[model samples]
Target: MGVFPDFDGLGGIGDLKQVIGALLTVVLIVAVLMIVVSAICWALGASHGNPSLASKGRIGVLVGIGAAALAGAAVAWMNWLITLGSQL
Candidate 1:
């Protein structure tokens, strides 16, 4: 009677969780990339003799990188939680 094989179903929020997980994964990856880019931009923006400017730029870049890395880690952890929850 059915067009395809019988299955339990996705009537639950399984699909939603999967979508959230994928989104989180993407966010994590993007955050990491942005962190790296931020570091590079700081390095390139700094020129010799500008101690104050270079120091400030380095600090800002490091802070940005740290924030991005933290966000990325949180996103990755959330994604993992979603997957584990889906399985169980």
Candidate 2:
């Protein structure tokens, strides 16, 4: 016998999926915006010779990148887990 996820096993699962998808979309948009704004800040800081601002902007950019990477990887991670579970 094989085990797998039953998407229809619960009531309102479809709606839950929709909500999660919307949340992910928002996360990606915000992350992209953060990257753009942080890059601009970085440029301005460097041009004005402000080390503090530049350092903050650099950290923001890294955080934005990390957020995006995690958001993007969520689906793949979930899939991998499901597959791994099924093999047990």
Clash totals for all models, in order?
0, 0
Q: What value does the lDDT take at residue 11 in candidate 2?
A: 60
For candidate 1, lDDT tens digit of each residue in 1-88? 6686333554655666677668767766775665576566566667555556566667766776676677667767876876675575
Tens digits of lDDT, candidate 2, 1-88:
9987775555664565577678789999999999999999999999999989898999999999999999879856755765565455
Give the candidate number with the greatest lDDT: 2
| Candidates in order: C-alpha RMSD to true structure | 7.6, 4.3
lDDT for model 1 comes to: 0.65
Question: Can you give the lDDT of residue 20 in candidate 1?
Answer: 65
The residue pairs found clashing in candidate 2 are: none
How much lDDT does candidate 2 score? 0.83
